[model samples]
Target: MAGEPAVTPVPTDDELVVVPLRHWWRWVGGAVILVLLGLLGWALADAKIDYAAVPGFFTHDIMLRGLVNTVVLAVVAQAGAIVLGVVIALMRRSANPVARWFAAGYVWLFRGLPVLLQILLWFNLALVFEDISFFGIWEEKTNVLVTAFVAALLGLGLNESAYMAEIVRAGLNSVDHGQVEAAKAIGMTPATALRRVVLPQAMRVIIPPTGNNFINMLKGTSMASVIGFLELIHAANNIASRNLQIMETLLAAAAWYMVVVSVASVGQHYLERYYGKGVAR
Candidate 1:
């Protein structure tokens, strides 16, 4: 045989390589199997379940109010979180050491403590000082319900803000240094540069995490019930207590939560895709 270079193997056009099993039937078969398994499990679970009990408990007015309360709490708390998060992020990145330390310490303290404990502490603020007046303005006595709502909002919002602050800071930091230099070279003020050039780019990073936090905040609103805010879970608790079908009422509550979360998830996905387009091109 003559001396010759060894030939390297190459695949023909008809040959499959990556994901070799590209048959459409495979995916359809797998999907069908999964559906069959799910149906079987549901049928088995339903046989022992009391569907009638679930319906009776789900029809209560308090349960309806609880759902509304959950929505309110989530909206309020997330609004507070966004505002505080932005402020804390700005403070963290400030040139002043005092501002930076204050922001860091605030985040450190809240992030370190349990959310439940914070809620409880706020709930008991009246016990700490039953009649404390702020700036001698309105000296009206605080009602338990109002106090509890405020407490829950404060606890949830402030704690959530710390995490959001970190997310925002990271996003801002991710912006290209060259952009900042360009802004400065163009005689833009530091604040103007940050507002115009940096924050807009950072929004691509920030929005997804912020939306996720909002969704989580919706679930976290359930924690407000612990402080007597009568959110969705609390309403479910009351309904279950009256109906003697705690499990069923709880399931109804869970179902509602699933619906709410699902809607939020869809919205988040769309927003994420929208923001992602900025980076893709």
Candidate 2:
């Protein structure tokens, strides 16, 4: 106030101050990454591959047939896996030691085995069992299992059941124990309680991961190619080999896979949102 230059306002704790900060190194790293990505894209574009073959893939009857087969295989295999998975999950959660052990052994064996190896094993199951008889009246040769569709379904479905069992168990575990007890107190049978009370809640936990698994199963169906199942990749392989446009055919197949995956992703998002309705946590 006296002899001091007019006092300037000092920033108080309540006043906001803007401080500009720069991380030059982070910017440099980002630039470098962008440059590398650009180069990679350019290289792919200029690569010595028959890009012309890719567009024709949409019109090719073989490709369309393979796509249909892939879709069918995915649906059938996933359906079987879901049923088997639920059963195994129930067994795993059972009070009986025998049932638990059986479920554990199944999960261990299937989860431990590589899916490719499992496919091969199922394909050659005829060597182990000469015939697969359903009943005295209904019988079939084990060789029947060697077919591409049968081999792929058995391998993928059985293998997926192991993963699904774990997933379902996790979902079941998410349910509150009190709910089960309450259901029992109300005189509902265990089966009725699970179906009516616990499962609905558990679905919130189950739907998202299960949707992801479905997508994975969709892609896994491509492996049926090894056994002459003319699924998408197998069909592409045949075309590529014949035309000597390996890269283009593969890219085409990859494009179709991406399209299917995108569609599945959209479906999963909606399903997750629906099931996640009441349970936002």
The Cα local distance difference test for each model comes to 0.86, 0.89
Using Cα atoms with residue i matched to residue i, what is each candidate's TM-score against the true structure?
Answer: 0.83, 0.90
After superposition on all C-alphas, the RMSD of every candidate to the true structure, in Å, is: 4.4, 3.3
| Model 1 ranges off by over 4 Å | 1-47, 52-59, 142-146
Model 1 Cα lDDT, one tens digit per residue, 1-281: 57988888888878856666679998999999999999999986877567777666666788778888888888899888888998999999999999999999999999899888888887787766666567898565555444778999989998999998999999999999999999999999999999999988898899888889898999998888886789889998887777577777888888788888898889888877886786676
Q: What is the lDDT for 27 in model 1?
A: 91
User: Deviation in angstroms for 216 in model 1?
Assistant: 1.5
Q: Which candidate is the best by lDDT?
A: 2
For 1-281, candidate 2 gives per-residue lDDT tens digits of: 78989878988987977788989999999999999999999998898976777889755788889988988988898889889999999999999999999999999999999888999889889889998877677888888646878999999999999998998999999999999999999999999999999988888888888889989988999888888889899989888878888778888888888888899899899988887888675
Model 2 stretches with alpha carbons more than 4 Å out: 1-17, 23-26
Best by TM-score: 2
Q: What is the TM-score of candidate 1? A: 0.83
